[model samples]
Target chain A: MMDFLTNDLLLLSDSAVRNAIPLLLACLAGLYSERAGIFDIGLEGKMLVAAFAAGAFSAIAGMPAYDGGWEMGAWSVWIGLGAAIIASTIFSMIHAFASITLRGNQLISGVAINFFAAGITVLIGQHWFRMGGQTPQLREGQRFEPISLPFAESLKDVPIVGDIYYQLISGHNIIVYFGFIIVALTWWVLYRTRFGLRMRAVGENPGAVDTAGISVVKLRYSALIITGILCGLAGAYLSLGTAAAGFGKDMTAGRGFIALAALIFAKWKPISAMGATLLFGMLEAIGNKYQTLDLGFVVLPGQFMQALPYILTVVILAGFVGKAIPPKAGGEPYVKER
Target chain B: MNKNLPKWVDLGLIPLLTLLLAFAVSGLVVLSIGQDPVEVVQVMIKGAFNPFGIGHTLYFTTSFIFTGLAVAVAFHARLFNIGGEGQAGIAGVGVALVMLSYDWPHWSIALLVGTLAALAFGAAWAAIPAYLQAKRGSHIVITTIMFNLIATAIIGYLVVGPMQGEGSQPQSERFPASASLPDFHEIFGWFGLEFAKHAPANISFFIALVAALLVWILIWKTRLGYEMRAFGHSEKAAVYAGISPLKITMIAMLISGALSGLMAVNTVQGEAERLLLGSVEGAGFIGIAVALMGRSHPVGVLLAAFLFGILTQGGAELQFELGIPAQMITVIQALIIMFTGSLENLVRMPMEKIFIRAGKGATS
Candidate 1:
């Protein structure tokens, strides 16, 4: 069974795994703030801002190759990564202030963030870059490169199942490997750590966490900053690490919300989120492959194929996979009495 | 000191701030591009609101009114109808296709039929999210956003595909003369302007005004409106009062959809008389800002919509005269939305006295 499945679906599955990495990274970013009860729905905007910053910064670094040097090229990627993190952090702070300090509607704040990000990025991109976006593209040598596993070439000579690991595990960018590591790391931080426990406590019962002498504001800020960093990486991966060569307005698309759906579908568990992202990735990869399959008279419009995940997301939320509950204080902004 | 203030004081303050901010931001952008900021503002002002600018302002306001109301109606039910632009665009195409493909006798009758068709199209477009929210218990915010994306793609394909215009651009064929809305300046001759002769403002403006008044009456003086407000104030309270959340949601979305469809009527049967992707642009989302600024009141929405209309025209004029981007108005408009939305959430009570009086001054 494994042999047959591997032979037929290995390439598609490999591509699905690659696609899911960035989405999984984004979901973890959402999970961080959400588990701490912040409901960072502006994940989409944050990713866009980061992508713009990363792409432009990397490009400015003179297309420096990743040869481990402190040259202008090295400074460029470093600056790009730094800018991506800072931009997303600043963007997330808007959400934090609106959802946390002002006690405004979290959803409205998120919408505002989405609008502001899109407007400002595109406006800046068009006016300043003369590129019609927030920034310019990264030069090829400055972008992140794919890392192949050792012995995978030789392992492909083995029997049916051997082809699966060789293809799926080996044929991915370096960021995909980090994305898998992030999943494991996130699971560890969420389940086995004190901070994770307190985050869950605050999300489920802020009053109880407050009663237990934890600073709800401090915990939430930390969660969001971590989320900011993760989201930056996701954006970077999307623009510089994936097939995309540059940034575009709303380039994150609705992947942020899809990741949110994945977060919910996984019941907020990091490991489950990884699995759910992979499943969604599989859906996308299979959809792409299915377009080429001539079912004759059953050729689905490619638009519908692109919209499949959203349709499924609506279905899942509607009880196709039963009810998925959010954090108790999901969108509530905590106001400190002192 | 004068004691009596204007009834529209609250509405006036935000647009003023928005204007100031927009000019300031545009000035900065101009400076960055090595242009004199002050000169640019002067040009923009001249272009958008000079004696010849009334026609475009009046025509644009006609559609703005419906899109703004579409958003405002949903806010009453606490639903974020961000798909207003997409809905308007889709319905505009629907009406344009029908009117262009089949000839109709009277322009008014064509408008009426096209508007009804647009309403159906808008409702179906909105129903995707409404159904998810009603039956699946999915969050409307996320689902509606998803719909906006899909709608954009669908509209893009249609305009560039089966419904593609005869011209090379991605636009539909112009509506027949019999199907178009009557020119307002020719029909009413109320707002006297020499520019009206160049490009006439039409009857759609008055229709939008009537729609605003109707929405006002519906919201303040009707049972359904009361139920919607109740839902907005407290979903649980509404449910306790025997109102089904699902039913109200569906109704709210449908009304919002229809309002957006009316805006499409102005686009297809009024002035533009053709369909183009993003022609409606972000007006629907901008309606959310208008609704917020108006406090979701019908009269407030009307006043706010007009203010936006004026700014939009003025901003364009500034660009034509100044060589600055006309979209500077958008920045100022967005800034106003941000600050006003924050202002709406600010606590009214004095904090110092309360904190001093009670150690536990945590409550709103």
Candidate 2:
């Protein structure tokens, strides 16, 4: 049991943290939109397109090859990350235009954006690479190599603390480290800034925000843009780190919705959302592990682990667990004078 | 902005113009992809309108009709039931259970039992989300969305685990011959006309029509329908008028779930003759677009479903003949939904002003 705990569980915890990065980023993405009164079910789609952009662009850029230099010289990976961010931000502008400018149903607009992203990524991908809508697997130099912390090698002699530090925290891709920074930054922007106050107020009561002489449309658009950027980062993280190999159709695979669930489970706070996403990721890691764990008397199917997050979401939403409420003005288009 | 134009403009002309705009955008995309946009249009028209194509179009039309009405019913109650995908998927399991269990001597009995099973399973699947939304103040959209993912997992388990057929395949054994719905060709043969063997259009087409009519009556005539619409329009007003929000939410979703389940009768019973994974094929999500385009009316739902049916069948032809990818169909569909559903005011507000000016000039 001690060996299992020391070795098996440590590995699982590390994998769980790695897996949680995209979900955390995506949750933060969703936080911006819902907080500012736009409901975005399109986060999955944005991330998908971003992943495709990241994979496809990096492959093309790094085709000439890279000599090992600083951090393995994976310049294409960083470029791809940038490409994903720009592409998703531009795509998200569609949602902003529809839900904000047109006074359309935010939910319907979001669904359309999801559809648009799913189709466009595959369409463009198939046309460009001709690999049945998939990007070619990245060569070593094109991938984000995990970075070991400075003390990760030196601290191995210490017992549990060393194991936790070296095994758990030391060897994630830079994107994973950026995820923590993103969450902290999100909390600061949402709780500690005037813009955050206005954004939150707009979600709660757009009418009040309008009365206070703030531009509701502009603020909402800003939030949408931030949503796009964060989702782009999530997508970049997936193709560059979690996947770190290639892009395929529907690759985001419902992580966006899980992020939305985390947003709700966290009650829409960035810090709590980080915690919820990690817990969700932990369930997924355990689920992946259950398939291989040797249990003599009991068998666990992979689908059960896969289904747990959704089941938990339903239970929580059903008031069976605890109360959670969305921003009051969410899913409603703000009309200047109604 | 104009308040009044002939209702025809709102119901018919607006959708048509938005469709034109969507096609125009799609045409640009086709051009950018190096395909001839004009050729794409020609292929779509020729492919969708052929006699063989009509059968397949209506076959898809049948499935969309059920899902569309399901969405429309929920819309009347201001509830977005996007779980039609999962509802119809699990309903295939319900359909398979009844059809495979008993060897009914007659197709009618099998049909009845299968229909009941599908309805029960779909309704049951929807009930949890509906109950949560009603009693717990949970968002209906999220609960239903979660249910869709769960339904996929459940069906995956059931098909591979408990219900796997004797064959090596994950699918169940085909239902006995008596369980099969009569093909449209057979019905057409009764009139001494030949129909396409390739297309799977079946008598579920007529059943879908009946379901649409029933939904129309339910929404426009029933007291419960009045209450549902009342709550949808204004919850505060509904509270003042003594309608229970919880009751309305539950009943609307139940009815919606039943209609969505009815789609399995077409896909499972009429077409595949067996349950399969992804049998719903995003019809549940497409139902949202259908409801939006149709304005959530039964007649409009029928028309919108038929339009999408044309696009889908036509799109297959584009793939086969012109080498256009199938994802283009999805893009076009998304553009249509975007333009008509969300960007509606983009077309409407301008058109409304034009109509207002035209009306004033005519009066003057």
Candidate 3:
């Protein structure tokens, strides 16, 4: 009985791990900027832009050789990822400028960014790619390949839990493991370091931080920039690592908000944020799993199941698990009076 | 600095600059893709205003006006109600169910039922956040957005599952004839205006107009409106003034949600006879922009909604005539809104100076 339970959990482990990476990376990205008192609501827009850029670049890189151009698909994927990071980073600057400098409302700026990204990406794809706003599929070697653990075979027949080890250990993309490491690194940087302390100080009371010789604006800007880079990587993973293609309209699909919820639920702490992300991941996994298993009873339609995470978010937010407070001065922009 | 600039120039600057920037950016994309940007604009304008075009634009605007008002009402109370899409949608379902079941003669009954459903559902949707704010102090913005997602999923499931229409398109069945509003385009066509023959302009537009006016009166000339505005300014002060933030939020959200339901009537009663999977795409979200541009006031909202309605209708015309994707409207709308919402900050320096001068005058 113990062996069966262990095997089942092991089998589910890979899916859970795969599901958690995107949210984990995004929440960390959000944690960095928001921790420093700047609200980065444009994470969704940043992700969508990067995903499209990476997909288009990869497609171009892998396209059939024409006009004496080198037919180098692998090189294009790398370049595409790099371009995605740059493109998203540039887009993040708009939010930075609006909130950090002009002190505009962060929510409005973020929503506008979301609309702008969705519209432009769809328009460009339909007008250019001619695939009805979808990018061409990348050829093998052009997309990130799943890495299987070789040692899993050696451990498969050792004991009652050996099969569990094999299923849980093998056949996941490279980015999944890296995403976990990033979460840990993010937690360490957010809680255990001098920078984290300053960020917290800036968020709670930027005026105080400023009085103590820290440039509140500079810290916020740096945090936003860091967020930009992380969001780019998360977007790349969505298209390049998981689905391995171009994006659809609203592709980030409010995942940025989900990450934000995770951020708040964890009380702006990176490690707790990981816990929150996993809880979300578990929701998503169960939603997907329930679609396949009728469980001897009628289930709600897939659409309802799909909305489960968002509903759970609302419920949790509405005191289902008590309340989650944001960084004290999150939405309010700092305006130093001359 | 000289005060030679026109009073309207300050307002005009943000809109004009936004247009210029959007066009410039779109022009770059057009140039890169080997399409003439000027040609695209010309096509859009021609498609938008050619007599036959205005009717369709009006038809689309009827719905936007309601959604815009819904967002604007909540804005007055300083609440974010992103459930406009869901509220409008669920209310649409409510209308569909009523039409499918009832045999009423007066369209008023159906309209009442639909509107009430929208208000009830929208209020319920928003109540989650209100309760959180009252009890646990959660931000309404974040919770409302999450509600939007849940609303989308729930509505999507309903249409595809229990509410599936006779057609295979994962939609609701055709609403009964009694439920539909009178089509005005047909009346105009009887006067030899062939331009109105194809458009779906109906009595719903007039209803929407009256609704907007009524909203204006309720917001500006009423005691409740004063309390709402006060709540928006400061919750602590509002509480001190004996205004219950919780009650105001709930009332505002219900009114907002009801207005969003009217959006369904515009579509189900006037244009489409049934509800589709993605009926009220982003009107709820765009209404935030409308409210912002309109400054959450009724008159401002109407103008903003009309302008956006024209753009939307024009984009649909472009899709039919020039084969351009309708998504361009989204980009343009986003650009316009982003610039407009940020315009207050842009003119803050000048406003401050003016205020300072006014203060000096009073002192002197």
Which stretches of candidate 2 lie above 4 Å from their native place? A65-73, A292-300, B1-3, B357-364
Clashing pairs in model 3, backbone N/Cα/C closer than 3 A: B119-B258
- Per-model TM-score versus the true fold: 0.86, 0.95, 0.91
True contacts kept of each: 0.22, 0.74, 0.68
Q: Candidate 1 — what's its lDDT? A: 0.74
lDDT tens readout by residue for model 2, A50-115: 998988887777775443222324688877888899989987898899888988877888788889
Over all chains combined, what TM-score does candidate 3 have?
A: 0.91
* Ranked candidates (DockQ, high to low): 2, 3, 1
Q: Which CAPRI quality tier does the interface of model 3 achieve?
A: medium
Cα RMSD over interface residues, candidate 1: 2.8
lDDT for residue B167 in candidate 1, whole number 0-100: 76
Give stretches of model 3 more than 4 Å off.
A1-11, A64-70, A159-161, A292-300, B1-33, B187-195, B320-323, B347-364
Ordering by TM-score? 2, 3, 1
TM-score of chain A as modeled in candidate 3 = 0.89
Clashes by residue pair, model 2: none
